[model samples]
Target: MDLFPPDKILVDRVKNGDREAFTTLMERYQQKVFQTSMGFLHNQADAEDLTQEVFIKSYKSMKSFRGESSFGTWIYRITVNKAINQLRRNKLRAFAGLDAMKGEDSAADTNADAPLLRKEQKEQIKDALTKLNNAQKKVFVLFYYQELNLKEVAEVLELSPKATESLLFRARKNLQKELD
Candidate 1:
């Protein structure tokens, strides 16, 4: 009747020195981690690197994994914090161009206007996102890009559900103002 093996079983196995169980756990969540990283970073290579760091940190911090939350939520918190830290560390270098995360085609495209039009729109949105404070940005990214539910976003943000809702509302208002 269970959709998947319980995380506790896998965690116990991992703690008991079962390397395969750890591998299985990583396989199960790697894509989710990667996608979350991509949403935060917007760069495939950086996302991949952050994904690896997330798993490595998770493995090292396994002792702190109390079953209070799902393994997925715990891993997500770690991923979010690390990704934010990486952004902070490289803010000057990465944000200097503001196009570093965006892929550019060197060859002239046949449909030039369309590509330029979309890139301009995306740049507008990215500029709007940059206006958000870290907490607002975190909530916005998790809710929109990561497609996490209100409850999930609350858990990831470590905020009460009501507080998370308020944060999301304010983030939306801020974004709307920026874009408009």
Candidate 2:
């Protein structure tokens, strides 16, 4: 039988002395983690750094993984929280340079100005996103950027569907106000 085990089993092993289990976990989710970070930070370098940081932080706190949620959901929460922290630590990073970032990780976006958006609009959107408190930003990123459904977002955030729905509503309202 394959002794490699699954994510939950890896978590169990990690809680024990099997450090390789964590490596397995990292290998499984590194890309997803990096992409999520990219969505939040919009910079490949920052996203890569944050992905490593998330795994390291998870290693330190592996004991807390109680299997209440899927390992992906658990790690996503960690990723979101760490990305928020990165945003807080460097609020000076401007989204005005989003064109540069877009080139670095071009994936064929359908935005009106995907190749080169108006700097002012990018700045306005970034400013609006930043103005959202942590809660709103989390919901906005997960739903809009990550394209997660309401139930999945609620699962990751550990909130009821109704609460998550309320968050999305408020986030839309707040973002519309900012863009207007």
Candidate 3:
């Protein structure tokens, strides 16, 4: 007897009104979803919120899943779309000066005593990522931050493998230019 069923089985169970099956799926994918969300939003609180939102949306739309792609790929597509939309909303808030009212420091608040060089590198990378076009940024984040392979990134982005590779190449080149 298997301790854990496959994602396809769990997905079917969720579609058939099995709430526990959905929870099992959530436990399996939540970390990856959170990490992917953080890769785009660059804020822990926002990423956590986005993670919850992604699962809620997925749960509501479970019946629409066609299984054309793997469950992981489908969930990742949702995470990416939600994260992009959140980024757009954040930009609008910043432009309106509402973000300043939140009184959140923009600096890396993860570690106070971290080495200066490491901190600067992280800032530089984050800045460089902002400069990328949306396609390049998506490919870069999915491939590097989410640790998805080229094929998986292609599947999630609904791009051909060659196209995904091209975007990743461009992203790396742009980042190099910005960092240098």
- Residues 1-180 of candidate 2 have per-residue lDDT tens digits of 557688888888889979988888899989888888876776667789999999989999888889888988999999998998888666544355535554434333324454455655675676788788888788888888678899999999989999999999999999899999
Question: What order do candidates take by lDDT, descending?
Answer: 3, 2, 1
TM-score per candidate: 0.83, 0.75, 0.93
Local accuracy of candidate 1 as per-residue lDDT tens digits, 124-171:
776788678888878888888778999999998789999888888999
Task: For model 3, state the Cα shift of residue 77 in Å.
Answer: 0.4
Stretches of candidate 3 off by over 4 Å are: 101-108, 115-118
TM-score quality measure for candidate 3: 0.93
Q: What's the distance in Å from true for residue 146, model 3?
A: 1.4
Evaluated with TM-score, which candidate comes out highest? 3
> Which TM-score value belongs to model 2?
0.75
| Clashes by residue pair, model 1 | none
Sliding window of 10 residues with minimal summed lDDT for model 2: 103-112
Q: Where does model 2 exceed 4 Å of error?
A: 92-117
True-structure RMSD for candidate 1? 3.9
Task: Using TM-score as the measure, name the better of candidate 1 and candidate 2.
Answer: 1
lDDT of 2 at 74: 92
Candidate lDDT values, in order: 0.80, 0.82, 0.90
